[model samples]
Target chain A: MDRSGTMLFADLLGRAKTRIMADWSAELERANARVPGRVSTQELVAQGREVLELLQSAASSGDSDPTSAAYSRLRDLLAEMSRARAFQGFSPTETATFVFSLKKPVFDAFRTEPDLSPDAMSAGLWTATTLIDGLGLFTMEVFQKSREEVIIRQQREISELSTPVVKLWDGVLALPLIGTLDSERTQVVMENLLQSIVDHTAEIAIIDITGVPTVDTLVAQHLLKTVAAARLMGADCIISGIRPQIAQTMVHLGVELNVVSKATLADALALALQRIGRRVVSASPAPAVRASA
Target chain B: MDRIPILKMGHALLVTIQVDMHDQLAMALEEDLTARIAATGARGVLIDISSLEIVDSFIGRMLDSIAAVSRLLDARTVVVGMRPAVAITLVELGLSMPGVNTALNVERGLALIGVSVSGDGEHDAGTEV
Candidate 1:
């Protein structure tokens, strides 16, 4: 709190900086040595040295409050280091260990100050402990935030990748949906199917829901919206792959998928072909083959 | 206000929207289309909106009304060549435009109305119904 007390702590830290850093590195290695090569020894030493230098400067400014302007640089550096460790998949404890490991080495240095009275030594130790603990908590906060951001980004990518519109024939498109139909995924599915309809000039789109696990009201509504959107783009949709259980559920729920639906993808393809005024026939008739032989 | 031109193709009236439809223009088109349908006695109306990129709720309602008016006049309205974005917007706006038949292009629209695509004599391609 007072200028003289902070000055004494900063002075001790600067004098014994090397000894403190050496002991801190040994402590960190013992705590996190199981994850070999996760961080190189040289990088660890450099990061430890940087943190110590910032702490010494902050203390020399006569401010023991970690949230003060004096400790701003140290706070920012710790937050940045924690974010990097989070992306590298470090646990919260491992990320905080980078800051907490300095507690023992610095306290040991303060213990050997011969000119200091016992009361002043204890006061200095209290300030050091609180400062390091505050920084460790700040580091963990940033780590948790970065991990959540990674998860959100991956979720967006997966949703985009899941809905793929394939052109089954010259005038038909098949969208084989393979996951639960959430609102977000439904939006993606609708956009992809409409764009493909325009590109291929498709007259019929077969939405095969073999991958959908259930047929609830919400899921049925989403499918109907998709079919309606395709119709607006001048393409009719054929919902195929209605499992027996899903059909039963649809009946029970009174959900009418007024669009033409088929029991299998192949049957839907046949109907689509028929609507387009085409049909698949065998290339060689059995009677013709026997006559030729 | 520049008017959206309407062309007579066979027994159908073809209106290709090349400019953005403002409120006034859309209103003008509605009146003009109804009058033309009455005067020409055409049995089908094909609206090509492939170049139309933007539409709000007003345009959506206008399309619905145009279809309704044409139906009263005993003419089948088939809106053709709507862009993908426009269709998505219409769906989101909850204006499905029921009773308005949609086709991918002018050729399909003609086929829907029983107008032969390759026939040279437009008069012979009468309404199917």
Candidate 2:
């Protein structure tokens, strides 16, 4: 911990990191040469792990720049390699590399904006990095450790998302939107819902977002698309479970969604049943949806 | 982000969609989902959206491109996600959902189909249910 010793160590770490990065770039060129045009997913992923191991050890020795540089280089490399879908596999090393690539954006966000609020920070970080479904969005920060807990509270929402459509009624198909809709999930939701519509030839699609914590502009837009696409097919998509905060966020954002027919799940159900010309059994008020849950 | 099956479901197949699903993360979704939907041998598709929040030109165009590619495979298309708010906005903005069969949800959505969905549902969203 001596000042000179510490300073010398830091310098050495920096030089070593720079060297590793430079060497990695050279390795990439060699990899491309070996392939003659395209690098296989294995090569990209394997190279990614090599870079991570070197950087991680260097990181352990108080070398932020090299660690950061290694991360930057890896990010660029992955983006380029991502052109091929075959690179997506559960190889432990590849998985680790993908995780590193995903998280690096969050880390960079923090490093760049040292003065972000908690919510803004999370959203900023979330928005900055794309979360690929197979790629893990793990956080080293203590705060996000309870993300699993957050999902737990919203189990109903979570369940509904993965829930397969059963003909609850003769003509009704339901899609439960349990969690908040990020753009990525929204795409999945859009694909699933639309496919279900065509597959089932559904007349009623219920998107219940009771699990969503907030509704930002992106989420709102996803909702809008659902309703529109449904109408084009001569069916109706009812969106239930609009959290008050989300309503407020929509208003605050000055985005008008007056044309979309939105209501609570109770209302969505009633409307859907009516559209299908079916009589409902539950005229009694439905139980209150969990606000936190 | 786990688009395992979606990626596996590549071109010539098409399915309908009904939402304005977009964001930085959506790019990956489009890449994988489009690939997978194409794999299904749909020969046509329809995206019904009456629940979406916004339908800007960029998203509208993305839908069009997706449908156009599906068309090249001789797969017909109908863009279905069109909430009233979005429709009005799109009209005002001079945009269209373009080239896909859009419905309200699965009922009208599936009526256009050529294949049957497996009884089992796909619930994998990378998070446990």
Candidate 3:
């Protein structure tokens, strides 16, 4: 019974390797179909080596490949992918597309490999899932670290940057700020604030803070600079509704906002009115008025 | 349904608006205030935003319109006591009334209008010039 069990295990490993090689060859054929011209022999050889190493790793890790032919084929196919990656010059979109191209075949073969022992099939899926997860993690890291990457690539995609301008006050300009203000956002803030200060001669600028989660040092610096800049342009800038945690962070960080008068948006407007010499004594209510019929 | 009136404070017209004011409210308020401005020739207008949770595009637009209309009427409009998140959202969303005034609280709003908050409900006028 033990001898039969060992033989069964050997049979399962052989079948799993065969399935992997077959799927890999199919991928190579499809890629070749897309780019039939100028795929140098050297590129093929190099890519072939990558596949070889992967198969070798499988063999060494106790994947009982019969006669090593399956391992050889896998080696050759990986070489092709590596060459394609190199030819594409590692552009993320191109690279992602290439990798994405192979995803289905890999998944399908992995899913349909009935010859694989249940354990072997599960292990293959686990390996593929982990690899895919790692790739996603890597992409996210790239996005954070390389601002230029996103800026250059997604310049047209950021619809928020060029959103329509809606003026809300006679001489009182309201700028609602949401999202975490990064340096990039700071530039956006600077442009909008300065332009509005000049264009409308904004007597008071209300910057409300309902969406920001946390105020970091950089963000604090940006806010301070905007306030200072607004004042320089002869505009009274009010930083309103500072959250509790943000206040604590601002204080602890020693980022002094002494230059800009701080108040709730309401207080800021009141102050703005006072600057303009207007006062409201009664709650005389809205004139029970209706829109023009 | 002119439920609210524009209050004449010291130097500015104090208009206590509905916490959730609308374009219709804005229009009525504008007409009433417009009449008052024509009647008294006030120089500034203050719309209190104390009881608001959120301020959307319509309301933000109305505020801008109110301010613009006030400017045409020669009364500078002010919005006071807007919450932090609301303000930030307006900016991020790029909503604006380029020259409206905003305050954190009523006292500051009152102070903006050159009104000294005297004891009880009395407001003494400060140096106006």
Q: Best by DockQ, which number?
A: 1
- TM-score of candidate 3 chain B vs. the reference: 0.74
Q: DockQ scores for all the models shown?
A: 0.39, 0.12, 0.02
Q: Candidate 1 overall Cα lDDT vs. reference?
A: 0.86
Model 1: per-residue lDDT, tens digit, A10-76? 9889899988989988887787676777888668878999999999999999888888999999999
Off by over 4 Å in 1: A2-5, A34-37, A40-43, A67-69, A286-293, B115-129
lDDT per residue as tens, model 3, B1-129: 644677886557887766466667766776787788778777777787757767778877877877787788777666776654455556655664556655545655565555321222233221121
Best by TM-score: 1
* Comparison by TM-score, 2 against 3, better one: 3
Interface RMSDs of the predictions, in order, are 5.0, 10.9, 10.3
- The order of the candidates by DockQ, greatest first, is 1, 2, 3
Local accuracy of candidate 2 as per-residue lDDT tens digits, A108-136: 42445545466655543342233222123
The residue ranges of model 3 lying beyond 4 angstroms of the native Cα positions read A1-166, A260-263, A280-293, B1-129
**Best-to-worst lDDT order:** 1, 3, 2
Better of 2 and 3 by DockQ: 2
What is the C-alpha lDDT profile of model 3 across A1-293, one tens digit per residue?
22333333333335555564455556655665565554543454344335434544544444343224534455344334444454444444433443344456556755665666766666665555444344333443343335455466576345355322235466777677777777677666667766665466565676766556787777777786666455433356667778777888878988766543444667766765665557756665455543332
